[model samples]
Target: MSSYYEDSVTLVAAKEILASLVESWALFRLLCLSQNLWAQEGCFPIPIISATPGSVIPWNESVKILCWGTPESYLYQLEILRNSTFEVVEKKLGFQEKAEFLISHMNTNTAGRYQCQYRKEYKLSEHSKTLELVVTDIMNQDYTMENLIRMGMAGLVLVVLLAIVIGNWHSHKVPNKEDWPDFPELSRSKHKCQTGPLDKALRDTRALCGKAYCKPGNKKTLPS
Candidate 1:
């Protein structure tokens, strides 16, 4: 039978090479219980951190942070992630390879995430990525809104004043008919003056002249 079909195809290639060597020895025993196995055997380097006046702060002020590491390191540590693990908080012990921490009056429960590590004698390293932090202010926005409101009010007042002035001017610009003299009365007074006094005087003078000139129904002779 072809030697039992070649030993069942060599026992199915030796069970696929013993299941790939038990999945690489269980990933090398989970990286030897990991503590960042000396930065995964690159020999320790992974430390860095940072935060000094940045990472957005403003509630109560004060920060610092910093980390660096690896010049033979020494100790360091720093953590702070809460509710999801991290913890630690402080340790120190370095110097020329940096370490600092500070954190004075912060607030809002000290913001959030952070990290840092280092050790160097029995090796530790790896753990500097996270950072986050934050706090804020809205004073600027408030000032801007207030200024806009003031400007709008001023403009409205100016418009109202202008309207008042225009209305006043219009009221006085036209004349009122009642204040003028009547045209017909003026014309009648002028006609009366032209036909009065002089006419009466001329009539009286004619009468006197008529009487002196002759006696009615009488005749007279006179000798010189």
Candidate 2:
């Protein structure tokens, strides 16, 4: 009876120890899972970097470099490299989730590669994909060429219209000789009958006979 009591006590103690070990293992696993969850939540995600009005900017114009995809209350850092070189031309810091770095009066020196990263407290995210900035005066040149083409076309149209108007005026001013009637010609004998020396002499002889009237029978018919 004494040996059975001792064996029972030993069994109970062993069971209790085993239970404690199992509980400890489970607690350890739970602690590890919680730690992992915290680590994941603390880590920062990669940000997106881009330029407003496209990557190709115009000279002496303003451009906006945007950094997005970050959580609120995070800080952002924008960095630039000229001509893809290791040298950094500019760096800017921001506090908003969506940050903007404005380059006013951009010039040749402003053209280069740009990248951005976000940070939450001491944790920092990986740098975003590089964006290229190309500054040029080609836009102005294209505008000038377009204006010249428009002016030239307008001048050509004006010349064509003026030619049409002038042609119409000239055509209307000239009379069509073919539409006029032909005048009849008079013969020489017909002209002489109308105004000749014989006609004039007959008119004078009739006038003299009327005035003579055998005046007082004084030999009025003398000189032939």
Candidate 3:
């Protein structure tokens, strides 16, 4: 006849609450942008995709970054930085068919906001997305529901908490860039991502081109 059962249930509830916060924070606190564009105009000349490290990526875990672009014949270049200073922590040069990258052996140095740099034809293409990776000391924290509720204000707190339990239940991201499963196990691939903005743009461009040339009425007129 121990009171331990009450503590166990409380722990479960607490985890549910805080997990929700982590998710909502990830969804709303982010702004996705592409860096590939015309140099002088800074115009996004091509469609591309990528993954920015998110807060959940665990220590020593690997995250895959993917991206593609217009002028499908061109190559793709990828780079990673752990901070806003744009410090180069990892680099891959002259990659013609690289769409994704697996970040492994992550440590403290790898923990931070991650940005994916896209390059095409020596010109910068659109950036994929940006996300932050924060390592947690799960071993030291109790992190039950009550403790988590103490972390946020009442504003949208319930909704955010719900989102944490329901994320990935309603839909999946279009492969542009995101971390999944759990941040603590980031070194592994939780799922596969096949599409992103780059993939969508490539598909749209091809579809449009097909309509212009293959459709019935859009024929080119000869100069009379």
Best by lDDT, which number?
1
Worst 10 residues of 1 by lDDT: 215-224
Clashing pairs for model 2 are none
Could you tell me how far off, in angstroms, the CA of residue 197 lies in candidate 3 after the best superposition? 99
Each prediction's Cα RMSD?
Answer: 17.2, 12.4, 52.3
Give the TM-score of each candidate: 0.29, 0.52, 0.34
Q: lDDT of all predictions, in order shown?
A: 0.80, 0.79, 0.57
Residue-level lDDT of model 3, residues 1-224, one tens digit each, is 35898899899999999999988877655522222222433544443444556446555667665655443324444444633465544455554445555667566766666555545546665555655566655555466876667755565788788898688665754543354344464333443254678878888777766654646786764324
Where does the lowest 10-residue lDDT sum fall in candidate 3? Answer: 31-40
User: How many residue-pair clashes does candidate 1 contain?
Assistant: 0
Better by TM-score, candidate 3 or 2: 2
Identify the superior model by TM-score, candidate 1 or candidate 2: 2
C-alpha lDDT (0 to 100) for residue 61 of candidate 1: 81
Error of 1 at 61 (Å): 19
Candidate order by lDDT, decreasing, is: 1, 2, 3
Which runs of model 1 end up more than 4 angstroms from their true locations? 1-107, 110-113, 116-125, 129-132, 139-142, 172-224
Clashing pairs for model 1 are none
